[model samples]
Target: MDLANYKNAYLTFALSIQQTRVVSMAAGGALESFPKNLPRAHKDYVVDASAKMSEKLKPVMKGVSGSSFEMEFDLDDGNPYLLPLVGILFTHVAGLGGSPNVDYGGLLKAQEVVMLFAHLEAFLADSIRVICLKEPRVLKKNKKMQWDTILECGSWEGVIDKMVDEYVFEAGWGSIKDKIRNMRSAYGLEIGVSDTVLNALDAAEQLRNVLVHNGGRVSREYLERTGRNDVRVGDMVPLDGSYIEKLSATVTVLGGDVFSAIAVKFFGARPDELRLVFKGAGTVLE
Candidate 1:
């Protein structure tokens, strides 16, 4: 009855519902506007690629945690699912072939980066559900709820938020999800990752790039009247500290989600085993 009973958990549930709706709407819109003039191959490829990638990544990409570790992503797979990442990248490259500032090189790279993060985010969320359900924390924190309850004290929302926060602090993907979420919302759709997820993904991606690419860093001097250099960059930036923090965060977030979803969907063994499968959302709550 109290508003506090809902709070953060309710917000997260609402956001999840909203995001699902937005994705559905976006897909519907895209389908509606499909040019009749386009070749059948284009549509076939999109459907085939999305389905294959979704299936392939669904199994292995679980619990990515948005980490910056290159080794974490170094899978040698000939799965058909991976074609979409390459396909999406090629589209942008072809479209923006001219001009240096907004040209093919930068645009293609950006497309890959965006697609990679999108795939990573979904994988992380799915992983959290799997891990948490399979290996849940003993529910000592809230004695009111039964230990057997899948989501203790109805605290799945808090669990998700905590995981996301940890992932953000650790990964460092540069708030790209936030930017994309905001952009989508502005256009009247509510698609987004949580702020916690966004932060972790950004940090992870950024730190990973710095480590793998041997990218150079330059210090730009902003002169005040007194000309005192604040937060100056030293000779060589140690990538170790930043990357470890990000990877740790990623683990927690993805792990938590896997736990929660599994608890919700598969707690107490398969629904048939517990005779609770029919007690789904279709039933009215007392």
Candidate 2:
């Protein structure tokens, strides 16, 4: 197989790695803080002005009820701070004090990570394009010219060019599912990114779309799209730092795995060029 032909796609795969790394590094500090730096309610919940004098009672100095709110975050791991942070923000927003419920910094960081993956998905499209072309199942050019479609001056080579061009270029080149399907059909390549990664990508797409289109309120459509049984309509989806970190890491690793898999299948070994640049290895090929 001629490696030079696929060099452009390989470069794109490498560039995707660099871009994701930069984003991940920039987000590293933000994730380390996780819930510690995230918003937290005062240990003693404050009461409204009407309840100020009554609130001073020994039994109820600040809060009226201990279990006024409850929240659960189903993530890759159980974080002690996750529920507390959510409670604090929810209480603040629900009118415990005034206006400090929303963690703007954390939200922005999450959005950035989501954007990073969105861009990565596009880059995956480019990688898939090259992988399809290099597939052994792909047929050579056909120069069959139609009765009147072919011009008198055009050679049968032109027909071959058209066939190759249309076949090569007409693969559904946008959607992630489309790219994955093409790889599978052409050569049975399976892009085995984890369920966590897929779920995160799904969440990111929903969050991004909601924020951009509906001002960040989790709509029924968002709920339907995410399919997270726990999340309800009208719930606010916080862009948690930890969630973003997991997503970024998963996608980056998955991209490398995909690159390595493609190289191994096509070349019967890890390509020297891929190793020199992408250093991609350990793609579970079947």
Best by TM-score: 2
Residue 52 lDDT (model 2) = 31
Model 2's lDDT to the true fold?
0.54
Q: Tens digits of per-residue lDDT for model 1 on 45-73?
A: 54555465455545444545453222122
User: lDDT, candidate 2, residue 201?
Assistant: 59
- RMSD of model 1 against the true structure: 22.3
Clashing pairs in 2: none
**What does candidate 2's lDDT look like per residue over 23-85, in tens digits?**
655555444444344234421222221133233333432446553533334433434444445
Candidate achieving the largest lDDT: 2
Looking at candidate 1, the ten consecutive residues that score lowest on lDDT are: 277-286
User: What TM-score does each of the candidates earn?
Assistant: 0.22, 0.51
**lDDT score, residue 181, model 1?**
56
